[model samples]
Target: MITAADYEQLFAHAPCGYLITDEKWLITAANATFLAWTGYTSDDVVGTFLARMMPMGDRLLHTTRSVPQMQLTGTVSEVSLEIVDASGKPRAALLTATRSVNHDGGVEHRVIIFSAHERRRYELELVSARRRAEESEARSVRAEAGLQHLALHDSLTSLPNRAGLALILERGLTGRAPGASIAVLFVDLDHFKSVNDSLGHNAGDELLTVVAQRLSSTLSSAGTVARLAGDEFVVVEHVGSATDATVLAERLLEMVNRPLEIEGLEVVCSASIGIALADDESSEPEKLLRWADIAMYRAKARGRNTWEVHDPSEVDPAVNRMRLLGELRHGIEGGQLRVHYQPRMTIATSVISGVEALVRWEHPTRGLLQPAEFIDLAEESGLIRELGAWVLDAAVQQGAQWSRLGDGNAPVSIAVNLSARQLADPQLACMVQASLTRYGFDPSLLTLEITETALMENPVMARKVLTTLKALGVGLAIDDFGTGYASLTYLKEFPIDELKIDRSFVSGLGTSDGDCAIVSSCIQLAHAVGIRAVAEGVETDYQRSTLLTMGCDLAQGFHYSRPLAPELLEDWITAQPPSVASGRAAGPGPAHAEPDDDVEMLAAV
Candidate 1:
């Protein structure tokens, strides 16, 4: 007869305090009673290492004694320890803990804290147990029920954990009307790691707490919402059809995608959802969770911030993802990687200002694969570091070769991308220095293009790494500028040389007045900061002309030349490009006299 409200009250007002921690001994959740006793708020402790809450001696005791005991036996007997209060005072308490594995494949522990003096009270109570049989029995029953409630609940969000979600799903399935069914929607927050990486774990926890509150409040009356683990949550509902569940899924995505401010930073994290419906045979909780998980991954793969419904007729992408990941590893090491260059034309002179090295995978069977196809794979598999290193080495070698060619018309520089993972590497500067020295490439001609997302993820670290790279006399560009919620403060502080306006705004040029304004502002912003403005994705004469008039310093897109193989790019360079704005050719090459046709084909498209 106990309801969720009853369990909440029980946990909040329990006679003893409680704390939960993940495998790493990081506090994940604490009950109100514990927070009150420790003079700390949930926010003060959650996402913080548990040892930090204790004094030096107690910390050592917990780490050396209690944690090992719990790990060996799944439980630790009451151990006397001193927990530090918010005021820097230590409070003596007895700790008893139990550890278990959650459905998400993570280990968690529940610790019940009791006052040290309570041990004496307990012995006294036992001495009078015969006289207070009824009282003791009632208390024992309540304590047992409290354990069940805590066991099934998530410490951080105070929502039903995985086990709790399974129980809810089971009840929904059995309690559904004869013709109705239960639906499970798996919601995974996108780019959450970036938030954590950039804003720190505290901010990530705050964001997760806010998100959990929103989802739970929105569905309080309709269905049950539970935290599955980390950034994943589940919503279970009783529905008549799949359409009903899917429609709800869309609304949930909107809720999750709305911009949020954690602490002082504004963040926008979208959710990719997967919905699964229960049938007569597949209505079990486990089956639905499995299917929904697979479908959620499908939503992510199809461009995140969307939803996907489980379709048995379709192939599960998990297996293919694994196979492709293996192939990509082979591609990088087995010589299937190719570096193509797209020319960057100076708007004023129409000269090939530089070339951005674009990586391609000449898969043994998949033909030529673009970055869009496997960049995420490489990123997720921790292979981006390896892949990026290879690209840097190859691009540097090629740039050095061209520099030696003495083709005064060849690109004056080459730009290479740095993934967030690569940027995070403490040794990134060293690696770049080694590569440049090995190739004997001019540091000035080796520009590094870092995405706004990557830079913003950890600006402090990015700045540190960038300062070192900048010291090497290489150009640093903020790639995909204006696409992320970047602070102008950091932009001004970061040691950057250029801002590459994202292609989206350029694509809308001459059509969307808003886009035109944004592009102009970006160019002006870059110029104001004494940095060149580069426009990406310019595909038409109109787009080109608008940017040129806007005083865009440089541009690269299909209007001039598509990204071509090294040899093809060399040919394009030798073909001589015309002064795009004046329709006059300048370089000493074969197409030096080629008149401007429809639009300036700087080289060959």
Candidate 2:
């Protein structure tokens, strides 16, 4: 319905700018709006190149671009642009082009242009908003990633933590191909506590970080290195055979055995490496980890700075331990686990003051199992929590039963061992109290033995637990006192009532001057703090005499009697001369035994 006059009016009065260009894209005609958009007059653009209207950067885009059917279609898609305005400032724009063709004259190409100032402004704002949104989203993602890393990494060494290691272990085990074999190596640094104690925690941290870096750097192709926690690092390798695993493990040992320089101090630490091999069928995180840990302990026992591969066919203590853990859980429900009393005699008075309640697993198929056979397994499997509670309940019940029986004048106290895992349990204090109340035994008659290592693991927590136990009037003794990394500085840190000199030192009292010195110092240390010293494994007269001379308060070993059932101990006590039974029962000659008390005690007991 439009005429030429109407078309002309529409072009002139249109809200958007309009323009016409020839085949060469030269500006042949333009409307007032178009002229105003570029801060140019009709005269200025009449014969000017269309390139002149655009910025130099956009001119190249314009020249090389195809302006298809702008005349035929009479409209073009929107395009963004930046052009110089009246003040020579860059103004944002959106451009659309249409084409017109003249038929009367020789075929001439013509194009129409529309200005989009408001549209370009909106687009620019949107771009800016999008950039900000992207930046914020990126920042949020990074923050979440950092939090996840913190949750699964060690703060000290900046290495994967136990949780992270577990994740990797799970992946390594499950992602293996049908025949793919994985080698898991558990590396433990030797004497790391000595470094922490002597050189300070900062130095220890520095050494661990350096060690972590070394462990990472030393990993061969297709291996992953992670710090499981503390001074322990784990290496997982996709290897072919046992020999390959052995080679990698040896290489790792050599790498970690090197001395490290930390804070201008030379710190030397050896490593114990344990390797467990896994195939698709037998691979699992907990199983592999436990086997590797067992192998690592084996390496440590053989001496550090060495590597040991797990022999699946070999009678691994860890397998037995895992079995024991399973058994312990069932034992509680099935009522197969029982408390066996090992009487602790007074050195000055041979009469029993207490009976250490040792845990015995009466396996239906496997005869009676000693604690040595499963205690370490319990510690490793985190089953110590349940085992410790059982011991507490069983010991308390037996103590109360004995109290009712009343050996003549008074009842004997019952002692039990508490693993480090149990001490870390938040419910330990309440559990102990509940056990005591349930058994109706005076809390004073219950003694708990903890090794030096357990006490030092977490001093604050251990101290809190011990304090609670002491407040309940329960006795606390440091078992195997001189065997572990116990510091004298921490002796008074806990409310300790007794110190049992390790039988190792006691057995060597007469033979080794070093052992004698240890025993002497132990006795002095005990007396200095008003805590009585009980020397275990006093089999020979010489060991007993040395302990007596060094002022040991009590002694227990074969020289007295092996840990016996209550009836056997009663019979033994009844048969002995009243003087020997009530007072000190001396052992035979010092020559009749080797001075190494630990071996003798372990053998006899």
Candidate 3:
């Protein structure tokens, strides 16, 4: 076990690659294991420098740094280097070296080499994994930021949306300094539908994007601009007073009015702005937004491209209008709306030919209310269609009653006014036919009166609707004629049975020649088309006489009587002179017609 041959065999066949280097750093000896691992024979590595096995950079480091460190410490453990094999391929290795004094007093290095390929590969994988994790974390942060941006901004314009506007307004109102006033301007583009209809939606979107950019530029650092859905934008800023709001609104209007180039087309647009202000911390966000919305509508009503401030004193009107609208709906459902009939008389005969059915609301507190007080509100609130339907049903029922009670010659036809919304309703013809059928009334006894402006709103659709109504044997009359933009050619196109001249022109009768000419021409035009002409607002006897002389087919106004209840109308008709009831023209009688002064005529039936 202690033989010299055994020791020599152990050194030649060690577990690690064993090598010996002289003081000059040349390999003096290499074990069989080292030669085999490096694909080199012992003879090839015995006289070669150990640095020769490394890459040039590693070779320099081993020569200069490793050698000196090992000399000072007498050892260099686990020095990493690249070794060249017999085939000239570099391989990773960890070398442990020890310096010792040989018999000649020269320093020699004893080295043990280990393959480091797996260790190097593991380190590289760890570095790559760390890089991937960092990239993933960065991507996640960016994605979260992008989602937040999208939630608050309009995708098309990149402007803040309604929610974003609310948040900004909330913060402004909350953090505002004492005595500071914040103004919120609600802006709605005027006639934006025309642009969308004419230029296509893609162009409309482009226009909206450009509008957002322009608004942002114009209000830079002055306020926050937000898009509140479809051609509506809002601006929030601190203002000094109402005058400041007005000035700012004017500036916004000017900015919006500038021509925009979108999709290679020049477009012009305008906006109506409504401004609401908060001077104190007590202001609520919802209430401010609502006030701005109401004011915007007021601006629209005043004609577009204008600004209106919400006045606290005038708030009752909008409130009252809404209250009246609710009451109207209630009245219709509860049968509180009474249909009063005003007799229409033939001008030549002075006899009642038909009656115009007018709806009267006997308010529980304010007494009887006229159509002028509520009809416009009803139309604006989208309640006119329902009101129109109720009126049609009531008029048709009354006409049926008249048919049942009257002789063959008695006037039984009824005229009911239709609002523009009713005229535009696709179900209007069907509703009329259903009412006529339900009441068993002849269609000839029902005349639907539409204003000239209503028909002109959508002429093509109006023509189709009118033609459909005419086919149902129901009469159609143009109410308040000559007050709209209807030309003679346009008039001739409608299948009308009568024209009720607008009271504006009739009020000027016997006073203004221009008014008289308009009235005369309207009557003549009606006659030329074989349709009856009815003169409205005939108050003075002279006006009635003049209309009779001008050959107006029919007339109705206070001259005959104010609108009367059904029972009172029957009594009034019976009390008329036999000659007048017989429809014979009266020849210069009293200078003034008797006014019906009865206020408490009938209770709710």
Worst 10 residues of 2 by lDDT: 596-605
Clashing residue pairs in candidate 1 (N, C-alpha, C atoms within 3 angstroms): 198-457
Question: In model 3, how large is the Cα lDDT of residue 233?
Answer: 91
In order of appearance, the predictions have TM-scores of 0.65, 0.65, 0.68
lDDT of 2 by residue, 399-517 (tens): 67757875542234666677778778888778888988887877766777888877877888788889888888877889888877677788878799778888888888778999989
- lDDT for each residue of candidate 3 in 419-532, tens digit (9 for 90 to 100): 888878888889988999898987765677888988887888998999999899877888889877788787789998778899999999988999999999998888888777
Off by over 4 Å in 3: 1-80, 86-159, 188-220, 250-273, 296-308, 311-323, 380-382, 407-410, 420-430, 483-493, 508-521, 540-551, 584-605
Instruction: List where candidate 1 sits over 4 angstroms from the true fold.
Output: 1-127, 131-144, 167-181, 187-224, 237-273, 296-308, 408-412, 485-489, 577-605
Task: Give the RMSD in angstroms, all C-alphas superposed, for model 3.
Answer: 10.6
> Model 1: per-residue lDDT, tens digit, 247-355?
8898898888789888787788899999998878677888789889999988998999999999966776777899999999988889999887887777766766666
Candidate closest to the true structure, highest TM-score:
3
List lDDT for all candidates, in order.
0.81, 0.72, 0.79
For candidate 3, the TM-score is 0.68
Clashes of 2: 9
